[model samples]
Target: METIVPDSEGRGLLARLPGRVRDLVQLARLDRPIGAWLLFWPGAWAIALAGRAIARWDLILWFGLGAVAMRGAGCVYNDIVDRDLDRRVARTAARPLASGRLSLKMAWGWLLTLSLVGLIVLLQLERTAQIMALASIAPVAAYPFMKRITWWPQAWLGIVFSWAALVGWPAVTGTVSAPALWLYAGSILWVIGYDTIYALQDIEDDALAGVKSSARALGDHARGGVAGFYLGATLLWGIALWQVRPEPLALAGLLPMAAHLLWQVAGLRREDPADALARFRSNRFAGLLMFLACFVVGTAT
Candidate 1:
């Protein structure tokens, strides 16, 4: 059996789970926690930057749970919608839905289960935040179709992924502020850059399947495209911080994250799938850098 995905996964504790449980885990992507971390960080940043993060540590924990549940739900829904496309994509061909290891009904069931968990997390927030969170359903449902109709589905993904900032701000302050808006926009640009790196792994297969992405849209210049997006992200994040504190320190707080983005762009290897996946996964740390910056600025007197 030729492995479409690199057998690079060590399986660790997932290897200890029963066969069916492991399949379900794979279906929800619990085996790969990067997506959940990517999803969690924007909301965490928003909480931290809202100036009450230390006092509102509960928001971070609740949002973290929501990120995991909702990220899993989104992946399941995407797999369900893209099962045919998945079958043609090398990396996704072995996916439970694509391989028929999981029935469509089962996949839908899992999606609903995960969604319910997300809802519980949502209800923990203020009414304003709850409404803001619910508003995201339309975009999330529309996401699976974007790759088919648009070359820049990552942009749509950016909108959906960065929405946590919107929800988080209202959860903390009961309304959106300029800083939160800027942060959300910056995070959107960040997603486009990182997910574009992720799209690199599927560029060849996506081309064969008629799936369009920023990776293919930029062609050989995909590396430069990612660099541009990361630069835009850093600039917008600076603006976000500056709005909170018109100080050199707030902008300087962004230097570490900016340098990390530079590293990703400088090291990008478009032709190497393993290298692309590594760069893509490294955003998990990129996220940490941004969160620490947010915390510093948010808590600074």
Candidate 2:
């Protein structure tokens, strides 16, 4: 059987670009911008929710740069750690590190360069947001090892990816509150749900390589399990909103996001890898929809 290349992700441009440029693109995940957007949206939502209009644009811009830099750093770090495992996985086997397109030392150098860019972005934030951003370092450093120890690594990833909520609130309000905390919690559950769907794409490869993930843990019941996670995420987000504002209208904003989650879950197909990836990528839309809802709820008079 022939493998099909995704339209958005093929070896076309990378094959044409010079070595250094292509390597950098692979390290930065330029071919895959969804990860950066997923990391950025929650921070944007938190800023909008705070109604700090004066600095909102600045915060969003910095967080956007930070997301791209940090997400690149993460991919580099993951590639370094998973070099061996990645070689065994079909989809990831062609990754720069796994395919021998880039060496380990060069990858580390690239990682440091991206981290420096991330540091520059961090310096642009307020003292509190800077500190909040710094606090994520330990979690980010520790994430590559989570899969080796737990099937619920997706849970830990949620906690790490959603740290932007922590950063954004402090950047905007200069302090943490119950509302911001609830938003952070809700975002974690949302990450876990969506990332679990992503893991479904690699269940077979993961199992063969002795890897642990939510999809493999759930096995034949993966679709139903993902649905349950998405349902719980919606409920958690609703709880977060109620805690933050306690207004009936505030809860109404959650309805669309909840409905979207339901749609993703209902349409999920555990047996089809392509379908799983499509569903996973579609969460970018889910993130956007939720951010808009948060913005409306937070900024509305």
Q: Please list the C-alpha lDDT of all candidates, in the order they appear.
A: 0.90, 0.83
Candidate 2 stretches greater than 4 Å from native: 1-15, 53-55
Q: Which residue pairs collide, candidate 1?
A: none
Error of 1 at 37 (Å): 0.6
lDDT of 1 by residue, 93-129 (tens): 8888888888999888999999999989988999999
Candidate 2's TM-score reads 0.94
Q: Mark the regions of model 1 whose C-alpha exceeds 4 Å error after superposition.
A: 1-10
Query: Top lDDT: which candidate number?
Result: 1
TM per prediction: 0.97, 0.94
Worst 10 residues of 2 by lDDT: 1-10
State residue 26's C-alpha deviation in candidate 2, in Å. Answer: 1.3
> For model 2, which pairs clash?
none
